[model samples]
Target: MDEINSVKIEFLSRSRNESFARTAVACFAAQLDPTLDELGDIKTAVSEAVTNCIVHAYPDSLGRISVKARLFGDSSLEIAVRDWGRGIEDIGAARAPMFTTGGDERSGMGFSIMESFMDKLRVRSKPGRGTTVTMTRRIASRADAR
Candidate 1:
């Protein structure tokens, strides 16, 4: 896996950008020859991360969201989604299952879903700066693992 083959995308922190993020991840994962299930998981996890940024990161402020995907040369991929908005005050509680800041409608399962679907998950945030979510997953390819 060469550096030139990596994929990256950037979009506004809006609900509409969710589709763009999903497609970008799916297309990149396809090039890596990930299994169908792996692709779906990536798309779902990406969607959750992007959605969280749009819904929580910036309430009324419009900002840009950036996504970068790189093949780890181990039949796995790493994705990072970043936003410049109000960051999570408590990452520990925010990541807890069923813990949402949204009053009633939000399930707060975004991080949980991402953690379950991806092999690894990391989150960094500052109170007033922003949040970045990093996720990685194995491609489920026997040949590529070598």
Candidate 2:
């Protein structure tokens, strides 16, 4: 597929930056003319991804998190959230629903929520290295919108 547009942003893995990541991706996805539902899904997925990085990846300290968003000609929006922190030891367990390592405070639905909201979701991680989550959602092209 050919790339239409792309943007990359790097920030500290902080709770506050989760909203920033969501808004930034939403703004970039705006060019695709996604509907309110699509926009909300994108934002929610981004928030979950960023929140996972802040809460799980850098559990004890701040680390670098990078978010890269891309727009494709097919009206599909792709967002990748990456972190340089303690990576998941078992991706299978991490992606499982309701399997949270973050004590009782967390519900462990981050990956599940992202998978539900996006058309496609991919997660990559290595212990002591980092983790990256990539998600894509296709916006329905409305004939009347153009």
Candidate 3:
């Protein structure tokens, strides 16, 4: 009863690509007719996830970051940002508010922001393998409830 539409992109783990990654996902999700607020939420969540991959994943070197977005028939979207660089050591602490490994330069609110904006957020990481953050949101604008 439903067909899923998806897009995937792989880019270098550079700080500059953060915006592009989120924007690309936002654009792809537009076909679902998400409201302005929903679109903004998706963009923000995607940005945080991609930024994490770029900032924390490689730390000292360049690596690849992959982002995938899928739109389902139920007016819901799923996004996944994955990094193959240095994995996370402690996911629990990382998800805590203001708990950042980057010191003063980082606010440590990435996961918190992602969790608040999306309907579902799942993060998986291995110390030496990598980390993947998957987020999902249902697009239900007030205008569409009628």
What overall lDDT, based on C-alpha atoms, would model 3 receive against the true structure? 0.89
Candidate whose TM-score is highest: 2
Candidate 1: list runs displaced more than 4 Å: 1-4, 142-146
Deviating ranges (above 4 Å) for candidate 2: 144-146
Q: Model 1, range 1-146, lDDT digits (tens) per residue?
A: 54435777888887888998998889988877877788889999999999998889987878889999888766678899999889999999999999998768788898999999999999999988999999988777757457
Q: Please give, for residues 1-146, the per-residue lDDT of candidate 3 as tens digits.
A: 26588899999988999889888998999998888888999999998998888788888999999998888888889898999988988889999999998889999898999999999999899988999999989888557787
What is the per-residue lDDT of model 2 for residues 1-100, given as tens digits with 9 covering 90 to 100?
A: 8899999999998799988989999999999888898899999999999999999999999999999999998888889999989999999999999999
Q: What is the TM-score of each candidate against the true structure?
A: 0.92, 0.96, 0.95
**In candidate 3, where is summed lDDT lowest over 10 consecutive residues?**
1-10
Error of 2 at 1 (Å): 0.6
Clashes of 1: 0
Model 3 pairs in collision: none
